[model samples]
Target: MGLKSWFSKLFAKRVVQKMYDDAAMAVQHQEQILSYLVDKGVKTEFGRDHHFHAIKSHTDFTQKIPVRDYEGLRNYFDRVVKGETSVLWPGQPVYLSKTSGTTSGAKYIPITKESIPEHISAARNALLSYINNTGNAAFVDGKMIFLQGSPVLDNSKAIPTGRLSGIVAHHVPGYLQKNRMPSFEVNCIEDWETKVDAIVEETLKEDMRLISGIPAWVQMYFEKLIEKTGKKTVAEIFPNFSLLVYGGVNFEPYAARFRELIGKEMPTVELFPASEGFFAFQDRQDDTGLLLNTNAGMYYEFVPQEELDKPHPKTLSLSEVELNVNYALVISSNAGLWRYNIGDLVKFTSLSPFKIRVTGRIKHYTSAFGEHVIAEEVEGALSETLKKDVAAVTEFTLAPQITPESGLPYHEWFIEFNREPKDWNVFIENLDTALQNKNPYYRDLIEGKVLSPLKITLVEKDGFQEFMKKRGKLGGQNKIPRLANDRKIADELKAWSVKTIASSNF
Candidate 1:
């Protein structure tokens, strides 16, 4: 890859994109992948004691396995940690992408050898699409700089041992080292104050293109990089850098800030990935949702809301699922999981057996005063209101709580906005309209047919999320619950909102 050829590819991203789109869709090419999982069972049975038995008990086989959470899976994971070969398929795991753990209360998710190829493949597709869009693979001859998790692993004296991060450190092909982060021992999840400084200091040691990670963490990293190097954007470090890939959580929240940090036009890709599987990646580079790994080692299912509320939801197969609708995801992985609810809600924008958007989490809804307000509804309202009012609200969160004094409760909203004073009133009205339209129960609640009235609080300059980030719960799977209708963390947010609102009122 000479500089001339690199420039040609970078400028000819559309051509590269056409090729990736065709290749990704050609799942038939990997028939052995699906066959390997269904026939071999892999380690899919790790969590559920009944996972395999359930698969065998039912004549249909697929219908018997129930979805289990991380806790259910942890029991077997203990054996896996002991390095049980039976737990995982017999393959040398080349890379382990450590993800934040929600089940064991630990932080790193261990990716196995069976998963590395697919993980690399998903990343490649993302890259291919990006190059197609920008024609900039010409910049570094396929070199990319990954801003990754801590590499020190578990033991300081020995090689790093985190499941995911360690995997990347030890297994990422030596041929690919120059394209990697500074070292296998540096930690990106360091304490907030030191984290940005560390990334800048460590980054000074590398010469590369492309960056991948959670957007928020990257945003903070860029801030320090700017301060330390006096460079306004990441582009200044890797002048020809073209792609930014991020997964986990809604990308909408940090979009504006990242744009400001980048200071130039480039493709920012959204990836819909989970520990269970690398489910999807941005298909068109510029498109919002992700392209499903339908042909991967997983059989996908959807559970409708009505059934989800039932003792057991009726399930729909891949061919049976539809679009413009929300459904709980149930996956049967090569690891032998069947009907496992991953607790995510997604809607399809197209019907080509791939490409969909994750609207929100099944557990992240705000239901107060008999009104069920979901992230999707809030997202729609925010976007609709933004376009209609031409406002510039950077971030917003809905927090519903109960007052300890009276059994009665009210809803509180915190928004980081910079619109007109009168537009504030219109913003509230638009908020009401959005709520009413997204869910009917909210409309009745708004009309006083229900309890608690919704109150809006203008969060300080940086907003409540920034404050939450300051408290050490900012990035990666750490979501500020929108409607903690139960007051778990919503109580804390409520207390803060009240203090801010009251102080502002006075």
Candidate 2:
């Protein structure tokens, strides 16, 4: 190791030690954060409206505030967007992270001066923890590429606005600026396809070691690299590439394809970051669950998945949660979100250290026949099936086929495969069996004859990519929905398939 690598290792050691110390006291840190937030919140307009002055304990907080999604909190957010001071947080926000929403067009999540540092530090600590665990700091010296959105900010709003990734880009520490790749000019090209081409041009021959992005987009970049250089594998193109950092979606669905693309096993770090807050990260190479950011400037609450739609659902604190139960994650952070429902469902893997694995979105599941199947279950089923079969999938999604042309209603799976399974019948059988084992409701429905066995529709190569492109959500933190309650997306895919078939015939 060089002098810089040596220094990084030393710094990582201290950071990792502190992280362990903090995680060991997860409940205490969360309590402290809650107190601090309430203390500051009492002065804000929202706090006053919610009678924060009289709040004393977590119970009092629950009585005073109701869990709310983005639409529920939009009234306060609108005031903040109009440049109102002390509307939500103590004062005007430093920036607003603009994210796409379903019912709401665009959500502007505040990032206050106090909270922005948490995002930066948590990401830095994730890396430091990896270095401490693996004793691999050599990647720090090589060119690092983060596939993300345009770093350019939109100042038309009261506060500067951009994607969360774009906002964090501006805060890249001065030391790493020299090592970060894809020049600012290339990063600013609003068009993702164009920007990727530019990135391919710039980093085709660089010593890339650390690559970070949403896994699907990173896969697209790898495909482009292979196409340009005729390289059989990404490992062949960048022999120095050592680490991959990914988030926004579960990595298991893409793991097999990634292994095929890289041609070797590589260390990966999974993060749980959102516009609301940076919540968790993989702290150990051997661990599947991400260590929750308990000591950060945020207090957490978990609502049992069954109680989410209730008018007054029960909320559990960090110390009160049970293991392996799906819970809708709620948070009150320094960014001024109070009892905010971020729409993510997570299951605790370890309660002692507060580690969790994201399961799915609260609203992003297929319950068409009353058998609720979530993203985690579907991903798990596919992953389990691949273990026994020689198959690699590019992308996949599930929806209910309520009215088929010639059969009973069943779940329809649209799959784009990198390499088709050697035995299609056996692959489908194994996948269905795994899913049934994971979700008992689905199993009951199948056994009762309410629904037939799931059917798979093979998508042409790049079909999903073209679908995303047509929807104008080609890249930068956008992800395909793993399961849908309705057929809006399924219908669109059907139309795309028709168009693709027609074009091919022509």
Candidate 3:
């Protein structure tokens, strides 16, 4: 590494040390933090702002701010999405991280200079943490590949976004070799496409070491790389490859399938990330859950699932949150969000209060046909019903699709599994039974109110998400709806996943 790059790494390490040793305790406490924010109210800079206290009263602080849905933030976000300057701070937004809203069409969230730096440290920590925790410098002698969205925009302008990813790429402390391939996408800027194409094309021509990004997309690239080079395995192609880094979603369901392709227990790191903030990350492949990125930025809050929809339900500041119960996440951050709902549901894995295991999205649900099918309920039912049949949820996208034969709607579960049962019929029946038992709505659906039954789709172990990523329909904050709850959303899922999954008789 160059001298400048080496010192950047050295400096970054010191910063990381300060974060863990100095700021750790303060960040962990939520009550004392309220005092801190109150004290620093309006005085705290953009990076230091709790944001909640910026416009709120001291009385509102303790009363537990009411959680907002789409309607709540519409006016505010609409101003930004309409291309107004100062929507974030002053100037027009530089990049819009396009993503599907929970109950609406895709959204374009804005970011500005002041709020953009929060991700730099996260990007830097990603590198430092890997070295400190894993004690490996595989990149010191090899190339690093980051597979991501359309690197180029439609106008040919560089998408000055990624919120965190852009900062990571442009500000990496001691980046070894920045090698990659053209973003695998269509209909945008020619130059941007060219740049992405250059990266992808060249990566195909050589070896890659530390690799990261949406696992589904990366796997797709590897598939193409194989087709181009006629190589059988990634190890044979990128001999220097050491560790695989993935996040944006759960890796368990795809674990068996990915292992078969990447070749068994290939060291990995599962990351937890969202546009609102980076909560935590996995430091080791074998670790059950990711180490909370409590050090990254912002303070956190959690309210019970039952309380999420309650008017002014009780909210727990970091210190007040309890363990094991599923809670809706709330954030107090530099981004000016105070008690903002990020739409994720999580359960704490420990008493320390710094760790959590993401269960699923709060809105990814179905109650139409009397079955209130939610991510948690479906996850629970699938696990219980398939207890001995299979062990992993690896990856799943549940939706209501029309069956050609039955000429009726049904709840479809697209499953990618390593082993298939000899009697798949009983397994499917039991899965349906489990869902009906967990939620009363499902029973009604079975009784003919819902108009559908359980349909199982066997996928090519590692498919699905790749199809979405190729279409710029994948990311950390994105949710794959469980019910195809509405028309546009349902049609979109049917477009990408339907074509890839195997046909079902049900």
Candidate 4:
């Protein structure tokens, strides 16, 4: 092997070996980690009130610390952001990550000094695990294109605030920084369109081996590259590109389009990172689910997704979780979050290594008329029907049209197609049928007159992109909500498109 490949293989080996060792020890030594965190933060008001020093077990921890969302912890987080020491973690947070909010507007999550390394190492080990599994370490010899959120921070606060990606960007190791595309200056450009243009210009000629980002934005980048370089596929621009590492949003809807962009199959690694913490990642090539980061200075609890709205829902420890059951994830992390509900829904697919799949987001669902459709079901239905129809979707989202004046209320889908189906009506029917089959409540609504058949509104070219750009959310980390209970998004889409290309109004 060449010297560069030899060095890459050695690096991959060491990274994977360490990941394996950590995974093996994580569950076995979970209790010690819990105690360590508790003892470390015992002097804080939260810790003292929650009796962290006196806590003996998971049961005590749960009972003492009632489940909390960002709103519940905002006071403490604000204090920490205002330069308070030991307000949450042993010291003030290294940074504060700004994330989306429901009714509150915006959320600021604390990122403590101890938690920074977990984010970095977890991301590193995931890529290394992919290398070890596939024996494709040659990518390490070439450059990687990381299309992430702007690295710039809002310096108005005592601690700088930005997206999780931006926070992690500041902590990238020096060695890997050399191989990563887009200089720090370009990454810090706050305007998404401008930054993407810069990235395209800078990396178009580089020997890009891997591409990492959210699927939506990465697809945008690839499309731009193809347009600028007159390349039919991304593989033509970056001939050595072999791997796609991504997270933040489900890939099912965009997978076919991505493969088409590359003009070849590429190995992909999925990670489950949030503003709260880096939770899990795909550790094996054969496994579809992500393995939990049990050793990563974070404790976990799972409450049934259905019970999340309850005043006091049952919380399960790692040992108490069962396979295939949907749970709302609760985490106590080195970031100083205590039994915090991060609003993600996940299901365990395996137990021995604790692998899981993110099912949906808590606020990101459509329960209008009690149909209770989720992101997983919608994406699955779309993927299955599109595959069978031999069509490709570009982007899509759905919202309930509940206030129609004359006809029955229904769910309306706004979609942009890369390859249109031969029979548009058949495609709509199949999608509606698939959704009905997956959700019985939806079936009941369709069976009755409570809801009309799904309305498929074909939008004009680049409609979704326009919507995101208008909202100032056109980037790697931002995503369109797949399902919404209200018609706000749908109404805006109609206004944006002005006229639907086609519609299925059955």
Candidate 5:
């Protein structure tokens, strides 16, 4: 065996051996973690204000602290921004995760000392779990690359602020740092295009075994490598490439295109990490849902998707949750975010190991015409339709076209294709049918003529990329808004589209 392979196998043995033995006793773990959090932060200003000292159980914790979105937690976050010690967590935050302002506005999420290790371990465990399950320790023998945003932090703020991926990059272990490709210098380049070029130049010849990043940005990197080396598939450039790790967006629509770039099917691990916390990961290769970090550093809560739109939603603890119901996720973490609604929606698939699938985002959907369609539904429809037509979708977005004066209101899709459908009309028809079958409200609107049939706008190659560049959001962590409540994105897409495939107006 190679020296690097031997060392990696040894390390993998240790990581997989040190399993969470108490994982089966999830309820006890959940209670103990909650109590620990309450005791640890009971003296903080937020803790005392909410009587954290009195919170003895999950029920008590829920009753004492009302659920809050970002707006509700803004006041505490403001105090943290002003450098107040022990305002939320036990001490001042060590870092602030400046999230991409996709939903509300740009948010500065606190990263306390206690929370740092949690983030690190969650990411580590995700990789280790995959290794344990797939017997793929060879993946770590060569090099791994994470396509991340700039790590350069802005210290002008009360706390150091940067993208979450950038912050995590700074914390990679020394040994892993040696095996990790693309030097930190290239990772901090602020320009997306420039960064991708630098990454390609730096790591093109390395023994790349594992690839990790948002699927969109990784596809860009693969394309660049192919163009530079005159190789049709990434496997031609890096023969040992084996594992693909990705999150931050649904991979279904991009899966076929990405597979084509790689030249063959490879094992891929899905993760559920965000600025709020690293929550879940695909443990077993064939499992559709990710295993929740049940014994990890955070407490989880779920509110029915229906109640989430209300001013005050009803929430359920992990013990009370059921399978198959869509729920908006709420979390209390070591970072001192208490009952904070992180804005992502998820549905439980299994309770034994606490497995879940990310359903959609709380704010990322369309309900303008009472046809409540979500990101999951939209992505699913596109993925299924494209599969039937043997097409590959690169990127897409939906926006409402509500011009009552000329035509009935409808949803317009802006699509960028890696492989166009042989039958264009069949592709659109199948997509519309898929959405209607998946969402009853959407079907009702189509049946009633309350809305026109869905329209497709074929975006030029790199159309979405150009649109993101114009908005200064062309990065790994940023994504085009999937569903807009208004015509803003639709109008902008119309201007950028090379050709428009208009459907008949109602």
Candidate 6:
């Protein structure tokens, strides 16, 4: 190994050791973080309003601060945006992470100086932990690319504002600057297609080893690379490329397509990161669960999934959580978010050191006919079916077809296949059976004849891409929702549907 790789290995060993030590005392660390955040919050305007000074325990916290989404916290956020000091945190945020909002048009999440390191270090440690585990640090010596949003910032806000990935780009450690690919000028291109074309040109000849991004956009990049060079696979273009670092979306649905594009299965590191906080990272290759960052300057709470819609849902600290039960993740961070519901639903895979797998989003589900099917169930069903079939899918979404012309109403799956399944009937049957097994409610609905078995609509190649592009959400952290409660997205998908298979499938 070269000097850089050797140093990386040495450093990774120390960091991994520290992480192990921290994980061992996860509860203590979380309690300390809660105390620290409360102490600091006591001086802020929100703290005073929420009676933070009186919160002595987790129960007290639950009583004092109600779980809220962005809309609930907007009053304080508005004050912060207007240049008010200490409206939320102790002082003004270093940056505002702008994200797409549901009810609100745009969300500006504060990234305080104290909390920024959590985002940066969690990502770095994820890679370092990989190196430490596998004793492979050579990837550190080669070029790394993170296909993300443009790093350009909008200074018009009280604080600098940009997409979370763009904000993160400005903080890439100086040591990796030389190893990072696609020069700043290329990254700054406003249009995603133009930016991707520029990236393909810049990194084509480099010794790329680590490529990171959301799976959908990265697939686009891979396709572009293949189209540009007439190469059969990504591994053929950059032989040294080995590690894939990804977050923002589950990788299972795209796993088959990615394996085909790369021509081989390589190591991957999954991250659980969002504008709210960097919550977890995959610490062990053998394990699918992401180790929650207990020592990070954030406190976590999980509300039982079934109780989420209630007026006063019961909240549990990390210590109180049990295995395999879905919970809506709530957090209080150094960035001034208090008891904020991040909307993600996660299930604890291991409780010894608190490892979790994101199951779905609280709002992103299909429940049109009283069969509550989540993202995890749908992804799991598809993933299981793919394992048994010879097929590759590019993208897909599930929505309830409440009003099909003639047959019993059922779930509609809009799928864009990279390679069509050899037997469509078997694939659909297996997929439907898998989903039924995962969700008992769905099974009941199917068995009772209340809903028909799910039907597939083969979307034309690049159909989802065209849909996202037309909606102006083509790239950079934007993704298609796996399951929707209504037919809005499903109806919109019809324009891109393959008309040939439309009648035949139904």
- Which stretches in model 6 have alpha-carbon errors above 4 Å? 500-506
The pairs that clash in candidate 6 are none
- How well does candidate 6 match the true structure, expressed as C-alpha RMSD? 1.4
Higher-ranked by TM-score: 1 or 2: 2
Clashes of each: 20, 0, 20, 0, 0, 0
Query: 1-506, model 1: which lDDT tens digit per residue?
Result: 67644654654465445544654554453344434554555333432333442343223444544555556556554544555544533432323334444334652334555565655556556656665665556534545555554554554311124534334445565545666664544454555446556657877546546677766556657767877888777777667666777876666645555666778866778877665677887767556767777655666777776577776567776556778888888776654344567778888776664568887777777875657677888877766666566555545677775563543455666766645335556666676677678888877765764444455776555455556765566544344544445655544554445332311210
Give the alpha carbon lDDT tens digit for every residue of 218-249 in model 2.
99999999999998999999999999999999
Residue-by-residue lDDT tens digits, candidate 6, 1-506: 88999999999999999998999999999899999999999999999998998999888888988999999999999988888999889989999998988568889999999999999999999999999989888898899999998899999878999999999999999999999977999988879999999999999999999999999999999999999999999999999998999998889999999999999998999999999999999988999899999998999999999899899999999989999999999999999999999999999999887899999988899999888899999999999999999899999999998988877988889999999888877888889999999999999998999988888887998999999999889999898899899888988999999742322343
Model 4, clash count?
A: 0
TM-score of 4: 0.96
Which residue pairs in candidate 4 have backbone atoms (N, alpha carbon, C) closer than 3 angstroms, thus clashing? none
User: lDDT of each model, Cα atoms only?
Assistant: 0.59, 0.91, 0.57, 0.85, 0.85, 0.92
Q: Name the regions of candidate 3 deviating beyond 4 angstroms.
A: 1-19, 22-59, 62-65, 80-96, 110-114, 150-168, 174-200, 284-286, 295-297, 369-372, 376-395, 400-410, 415-423, 426-453, 457-479, 482-506
RMSD of each: 5.0, 3.1, 6.0, 1.8, 1.9, 1.4
Q: Provide the lowest-lDDT 10-residue window in model 5.
A: 497-506
Q: lDDT score of model 1? A: 0.59
Q: Pick the candidate with the highest lDDT.
A: 6
Model 3 residue-pair collision total: 20
Q: Which is the winner by TM-score between candidate 2 and candidate 3?
A: 2
Q: What is the TM-score of each candidate against the true structure?
A: 0.79, 0.97, 0.74, 0.96, 0.96, 0.98
lDDT of each residue in 163-196, candidate 5, tens digit only: 8888988899876888886798998789999999
Tens digits of per-residue lDDT for model 4, 397-478: 9888888666788888888888888987788888999999989999999899799888777777788888989887788688
TM-score, candidate 2, is 0.97
Q: Give the worst 10-residue stretch by lDDT in candidate 1.
A: 497-506
Q: What is the C-alpha local distance difference test score of candidate 6?
A: 0.92
